[model samples]
Target: MKAVILAAGYGTRLLKDLQGADEQHLQDLTGTPKPLLPIAGFPLISYWIEALRGGQDPIDIFIITNELYQGKFKDWAKNYPFVTVISDGTSTNEERLGAVSCLQLIIEAFSIDDSLMVIGGDTLFYEDFHLQDVVEEFEVLYRGNNQANLVLSYTCKDDETKKYGIVETDESSRIRAIKEKPSPPETASRQACPCFYLFSRHTLPCVKEFLNEKKDAPIDEKDAPGHFLSWLVTRRPVFSTSIAGRFDVGNLESYRLCNKYFQENIRKLNYLQ
Candidate 1:
């Protein structure tokens, strides 16, 4: 299987938040990309590399980044021989290809004919997340239906519902529909879907079809991966697996919280060991 980490975002929000910060902060994060941000004494994307490296199936990792940050990613990837960094030929967020387009680019560029694991470059799961377990569950689902794809969802507060793509699943955990940032009253489901997904090889062509149909649409409609998932659940057999939680490092506050959490968790683990 192949894993693609979508890191093409320019981290404009984070940069804006860092304005007027101390000299140390500015020097540390001025040109740093989101995925390359230091978390718990390690690069943010390196955590994903450690998690995915020793899995049963040999997985090749591909990171797609913008031209502005491609050099940084390539430098960080030197320590990880298995990772391939690709530039989407975009220097700024405004000119960058959307996440859906990035995914499609990796698909066509790599000629991937196998199951693909799509993960958000700026997001990470909680301790309860086990990659092997999730892959195994996806394998079982794939056995039952070759077109089945798995997505990760976590319960969020009602007020926070508008910030994420809420997934409504049936009793059997099959995704019924995905509501993209719907108001709390608009949907009863509080299951916020993250960017982690395992797509079966049989359903790979649907991604191209989605892009083709949305060719004339605005960038907002095709930018976030949730839009693609919201469009896909209806046409494909997508299922949901509940995870403990996820950290989406969008701005400075969120990044600080994620870093603190990881630092504490790592400290506790070392103490226990």
Candidate 2:
């Protein structure tokens, strides 16, 4: 399977938070892209590279970044010869092609016709996350039905439902509907879906279809990949696999927390070893 990493976001929020920050370590992050930002002594995206490469089966990995950060990503990618970095030709936040469109760009550019693993470059999961398990689950579902797709979900508190794309799943974990940022009373299900997805080859065409349908719609409709998945659940068998949790490095605070979590975990792991 091929993997596509969406790193095209300009990270305006994070940059804003970094401005005038007192932390000495954070000062160096002024112009860094979210994916390339240092986390636990390593570039955030390196964790993904290591995990994907560690798998027994070889997989092609592609990273999509904006023009502003293309050079940085390309330079970092030199360490991993297997990775291909593509700039979306967007120099500013306003010009970005959005996460879903970036995924489509990789699809069209590479002419990928196999199952795909799509991940948000700024997102990472807790220690319990095992890419192999998710891949195996998707493989089983795909073998049963080629139209099946998989997404990672984590339980969120009722009050936190409004901050996420809540997924309602059936007894078999097949997603019935995806409510985008609905309030507590809007849905009983507390499963919050993250940006990680495994799409079957048969379902790839639906991505283009979704884009075409939303061509004239607002950028919000096309911006987030979750919007596309919410629409896809109605037309395809999109299932959810529960994960421990996920960290989204959208702003400075979240990035700091994510970095601290990894740093602490690494220390504990080393002590045990």
Candidate 3:
């Protein structure tokens, strides 16, 4: 199996907090360019690689980050044998490509056609949850002639649901619809979509078409994956599996919360010496 991680964002919100901190500690303090943030003495992306490798099948990992951090990531991850880092180039002025577009670029660059896993660089999840199980489940669903897309869902009852892409699933565990941060009382269930997704080769063509169409369109499309996913679930089959716990380390509060959670649970993640 192959995994693609999206790490190109500038993380403007995180840098806001890091500006006042000392230059040396700034990176550790805010965890911006999230994949490079320390999780236990190692970069956050290291933990992700560990989790994916800890799964039943060995995976080839590909990371997509902006050009500036490419060297740093390469230096930090040199010891890891399976990782391959790809740079998106350094130019924030350019209207950046959305998550799916980045994935398409990686696929086209590498000529990949088998099942692929896509994840956000800044997200973390339970230590016990094996990414292999999720990948295996995707294979089962796809082999059953289900469809090309499978989204990992997490059941969050707390107030955090407002910050995520919420999902509505059918009785058989297939995703029916998804809404991004809908009004609180207007929701049907608390299951939300995390950053992890599995897709078959068939989705690539649709993604290319979507990107091309958006390029010619005048309006900017926010939440590209969600929009593409909503269409996918309606026209074809899509499956969802509930993950127990996960964290989005994109902001100050969540970054602190994730650090605390890791400290309390995963003792091995001592990032600061």
Report the number of the highest-lDDT candidate. 2
- Give the per-residue lDDT digits (tens) of candidate 2, residues 193-271: 9989999998899989999999999888999999999999999999999987889999888988999999988654221
Which prediction has the highest TM-score against the true structure?
2
On a 0 to 1 TM-score scale, where does candidate 1 land against the true structure? 0.96
Question: Model 2 segments beyond 4 Å from truth?
Answer: 267-273
CA deviation > 4 Å runs, candidate 3: 21-32, 146-148, 158-161, 217-224, 267-273
For residues 1-273, write the lDDT of model 1, one tens digit per residue: 899999999888888876746667655687788888988888888888887886866789999998999999998998989999999998987897899999999999999999999999999877777888899999999999999999999999999998999999999999999988899999999999999999999888998999999999999999999999999999999999998899999988898898888887875422112
Model 2 error, position 99 (Å): 1.0
Indicate the TM-score of model 3.
Answer: 0.87
In order, the Cα lDDT scores of the candidates are: 0.89, 0.90, 0.73
Listed per candidate, the RMSD to the true structure in angstroms reads 2.1, 2.1, 3.4
- In angstroms, the error of model 2 at 115 is 0.1
Which structure is stronger by lDDT: 1 or 2? 2
Model 2 is weakest, by summed lDDT over 10 consecutive residues, at 264-273
List, residue by residue over 1-273, the lDDT tens digit for candidate 3: 689988877777777767655566655565347777766555788777777777656778898877767787788768887888888765462555667677777888888877778888888887656666677888887888745578888888757567777888889898888887776787877888888888876765666777676775532362346666765677667788887878877666676688777878775432221
Q: lDDT (0-100) at residue 244 of candidate 1?
A: 82
Per-candidate TM equals: 0.96, 0.97, 0.87
Count of backbone collisions in candidate 3: 5
RMSD of 3: 3.4
